[model samples]
Target: MRWALVGLVTFVLFFPVLAAFFILLPFDRDRKHIHPLISFWAKAVLTVCPLIKVRLEGAEHLKQNGTYVLVANHQSIGDIIAILHLSHSFKFVAKEDLFWIPCLGWALWLAGYIPLVRGDRMSGKRAVDQASGYLKRGVSVLLFPEGTRSPSGEIQAFKVGAFKLAAEVGVPIVPIVIHGTRDFLPKGSRLLARRVQVTVKVGIPQQLAAKNNGSVESFSDQIREEMIQSLKSIRSQFKTGELVSV
Candidate 1:
């Protein structure tokens, strides 16, 4: 019931902002104009959810003016709010199904978020192409290479599309490690819980060189490795029960 209310109030309160963003769609081709409003909505949601506290680290590594393909592990629906807290303006490479949602979906479309139809080869290629265009235009796009939320909160193997898009655009890749969202709202459930400390680590951007053979498989593996180490470091904190002071 708590999460339900959060969702309801979030939509109700933010509906006007969403409509305004939609009206500005013509001028928000790069999504730069609407990002701050989106950030405000996301931050508002987190503020209303008293149980979740976010601690961000390594954000200094994110350059204020640099463009990147930001990749992160997806643990639960809450990851979206957590990532938005970073306040970095990036369009999310989201699932096509999400675009069908009423107001929220319309807002995403107006803001230029790219959507991908899972398991469709053609849709994947189109998504990569769309993301490439956004990158070339000096906009960063966020991709969850895991493709879906982790049922076990374990970082899964990455898909190659994000790396491929990065290589195609010749931009650096930024790996973001997220921890504890699963405990806040587990997979397949909307129940909200409190006192959950969500930690986010933004690693230094990495420039990936596409191998001569042109396959980004190795590049994807390298990023997955780096994120795995980050998650491991965060898990150790859980054992100690001493949350970092942010």
Candidate 2:
């Protein structure tokens, strides 16, 4: 009930601001403050949804404005809000389908997001190349290499695509272990009445070896293991059950 109301209000508030962004795009392409502004708005949305007090650790380890490939375990939609609230130069390489969100979609495109379309080889290649080039231009990328939200919030095997892009772009990977969000809001759950405390553990950045054919695979494994070790209990919570989507 509470979350539903908040979501409705959020949609109402965000749409206008997004509309204004587009309305002014032709007149002025200046969006230097856009990232922080959108982040501030997202924080308000979190406040309204009344997310449990978030406990963030190792945040000091994160570079305030540094560019790196941020790799996090998939949990829930709330993860996106948490990320926007925490990260400074946060940009995402997300599903191509996300481009369909009306106002927000336009904002993301103007903000330089790299869209990933799965199973379409040509389209995927185009997105991958865009990601690689974006890194070269100093844009940081966020990826949920698990491909989809873990229905049970149990960390799944990461696909190799994100890692390959990181290695190709010569950027370090920042592995994040997120906990408790799945319980608060799982995939396909409409009610958001529970207050579930969340924790985000930002691990150290692991730089991949350049020019090594096998190093990318090794680096991906290391990141996966580090996340699993850090999120042991959270993974157990998923044992309760999962609502698998067909």
Candidate 3:
């Protein structure tokens, strides 16, 4: 029943919003104007599905007018929805297949989000170039450095692309850890869980310098370790009810 309501909302809002996006494109060349609309759409979807609750913390770490290379651990499709609740404006580095998903894909393209073809060197290079351009233009770009969803909901080995992009563009790397989305909508399942609490913890932005001596791989590992510790902390806080949902 919840899923039906969510779908109904999406179906009703998707077309009109998409049309508005197209009509506004000529005036919104930088695509900055589209993000807030997308964020609103995401919020509306979440609002209709009362079963999935989202809590966000460390939002203070994000500064207005700050460009970031935002990295987050991937758990499920729900992670995207949960992250959209953030007030920060950013472009997502999403998989190419997601760009083929009807209205959702079209919206992504029109919004100037980067699409990556996994395992394709040329595609990855293109995505990096595009994301770097956005950062250079003072827009944040979000990527799941794990490259794909972690089936077991554990922090997987980090991929170096996100860190490399940050290093290239000289932007701060902000680590965001999301928990409980794996249970909300696990991989390989179309059905949403009946009730789930999703928490997103945004960590302080770490500026990349010569600390790793130009070794993006090592830097990526360092960031991943910090996120691993963050995940542990979020779980502990959730259990003890230490976090205040915002």
Clashing pairs in 2: none
lDDT of 2 by residue, 74-162 (tens): 88876766766665565677778766776456656665566877777887788777767667877777889898889987789988777
lDDT string for model 3 (1-246, tens) is: 977998888778777677877788888766877887777777888888876888889989999789999999999988887898888889999999888886667767877899999999999989988888889989999999998999999999988888888987888899999998998899888987657788889999987668878788878888999999999998888678885332
Question: Where in model 1 is the C-alpha error above 4 Å?
Answer: 1-9, 102-104, 209-215, 244-246
User: Residue 172 in candidate 3 has what lDDT?
Assistant: 88
Ranking by TM-score: 3, 1, 2
How much does each candidate deviate from the true structure in C-alpha RMSD?
A: 2.9, 5.5, 2.2
Candidate 1 whole-model C-alpha lDDT, 0 to 1:
0.83
**Of candidates 3 and 2, the better by lDDT:** 3
Best by TM-score: 3
How many collisions between residues are there in candidate 3? Answer: 0
Error of 3 at 130 (Å): 1.0
**Local distance difference test values of all predictions, in order:** 0.83, 0.72, 0.86
Model 2 is weakest, by summed lDDT over 10 consecutive residues, at 237-246
Off-target runs (Cα >4 Å) in candidate 2 are 1-32, 51-53, 101-110, 209-214, 233-246
